[model samples]
Target: MLRRRRKFLEEGYNCALCQDGVEETIEHLFFSCSTSSCRWLVLGIFWNDGGNIFDKLSTAKQAFPFPFFMEVVMIGPWCIWKERNALTFNGKAPNLATWKNDFKKEVRGHLCRIKSSLHDSINFWLDAL
Candidate 1:
């Protein structure tokens, strides 16, 4: 997280949706903040609400397993940045649900492509099945 924040800040940006102010906050980038079009209700703030969310994202396991967590941690920020660019460069502002769906699918696809596996061989086989 620290690593990512430094990198993004060096690159320059706030959260794409709100554009109010975002300082490399993982929760804001991935979960919180309302979109440009709609003024009510944030995108995925339901999953927000943690101080060191990047840390949580990096090492979470209650719901998503490690590989899935890593996928989100890695891809969520890129999605946000891409959305921001799309809006600024291409004049496209996607809906909240669209962003959320994209996030989920991206994470899932990333995990699949990375060929993530569970701890045990049997578990991996079962998951593959």
Candidate 2:
């Protein structure tokens, strides 16, 4: 449901987040866009322009513990999508602080659902951030 695909179906679709008039593909929105790139960089994840998000995740998975990586994979893009929606629908500008705060909030919330054994590891990772 990226703007690139939607553009094919309709017309005048552009990336809501960047507003750079680029066709918003899943890869572009979540991986390659400047906004997303900054987010990833802050997380210490540097994505190459070689492939899609999943491909990048596959490469990254080799570097990090799986559970922590999965948390990143889930929460990061969810924040990006929420930012996209905020801009697309509410005219709110993207805020990195807000994104970070939201990510922390989500990580904290997720802690309640996971096993207690992982709390220290997850909290350690979160603290490192």
Candidate 3:
């Protein structure tokens, strides 16, 4: 559950990721926060922040090759979630380089499950990063 929901259910919850005292909603945590915006920008995904998460994702999907986009969609939020948990529970700070490394490692590990024909293309994309 998000801090916003937790606030309603209990008391005194704030966004652990940004530390900006904003109520943490799914949208804020994954899309609207400055940290998340920077991550999306690094991925070359820009949006107007006018729509819901699904709408934003749909727009982003149109911008990248489907296979690569799918991999990013699967791993990106998970990286963010993991970082959030690390901060919330272990008092670790969020690190963009750590997130990038984790994302790359995860995508590489998943290559065995992807079609061999796309491996070259995916490897090229990963190399460019």
Candidate 4:
């Protein structure tokens, strides 16, 4: 993204993803991209069916309420990206099942710090389950 950002600026474009055609900005790609993964982030294609990106990001950045439901969501895409790289570079096929399991493991491994920052603690467990 850094390279793309630099290149985009050098090319006088506002966005690498949209080529300055729309409201192209990093925030848009991060929280508003229409790509499947980004849409998943905003629309909860699998993890966040109850709200949009604004609500989700606010919840993820929360320092109160003791609900870590957002942590799982936050950590999920890293695992997905790793799987994406493995498939892209290793010539292996995608495996949603294994990817999900690994995502859970990864989330659990780093989720302790975020455990206290949730809207409802129970919601975290529900999401993990």
* lDDT for each candidate structure: 0.50, 0.76, 0.75, 0.49
Once fitted onto the true fold, the runs of candidate 4 whose alpha carbons sit more than 4 angstroms away are: 1-66, 116-128
Identify the leading candidate in terms of lDDT. Answer: 2
Q: Per-residue lDDT for 36-121 in model 4, tens only?
A: 24434432433233477676566555623334545655675566556544543454455656665676577656745654454355
Model 2 misplacement above 4 A: 1-11, 65-67
Per-residue lDDT, model 1, residue 120, is 47
Among all candidates shown, the one with the greatest TM-score: 3
User: In candidate 2, what are the lDDT values of residues 20-110, reduced to their tens digit?
Assistant: 8788988889888888888887777666668766778788777665466777777889989998877665657788888877777888888
Q: What are the clashing pairs of model 3?
A: none
Candidate 3 vs candidate 4: the lDDT winner is 3
Residue clash pairs of candidate 1: none
lDDT string for model 1 (24-110, tens) is 464555556655323112221124356476655433435443343444446656766677666655656656666666665665555
Write the candidate numbers in order of decreasing TM-score: 3, 2, 1, 4
What is the lDDT, from 0 to 100, of the residue 56 in candidate 1?
A: 52
The true-versus-predicted C-alpha distance at residue 44 of model 2, in Å, is: 2.0
Please write out the lDDT profile of model 3 over residues 1-129, one tens digit for every residue: 355445434534667777787888888888888887777666666655788777887888887654668677777788888888877666677888787787778778999988898889877776776
- For model 3, the stretches where C-alpha displacement exceeds 4 angstroms are 1-11, 65-67
Ten residues in sequence with the least summed lDDT for candidate 4? 39-48
Clashes in predicted model 2:
0
Question: What is candidate 2's local distance difference test score?
Answer: 0.76
lDDT of 1 at 95: 62
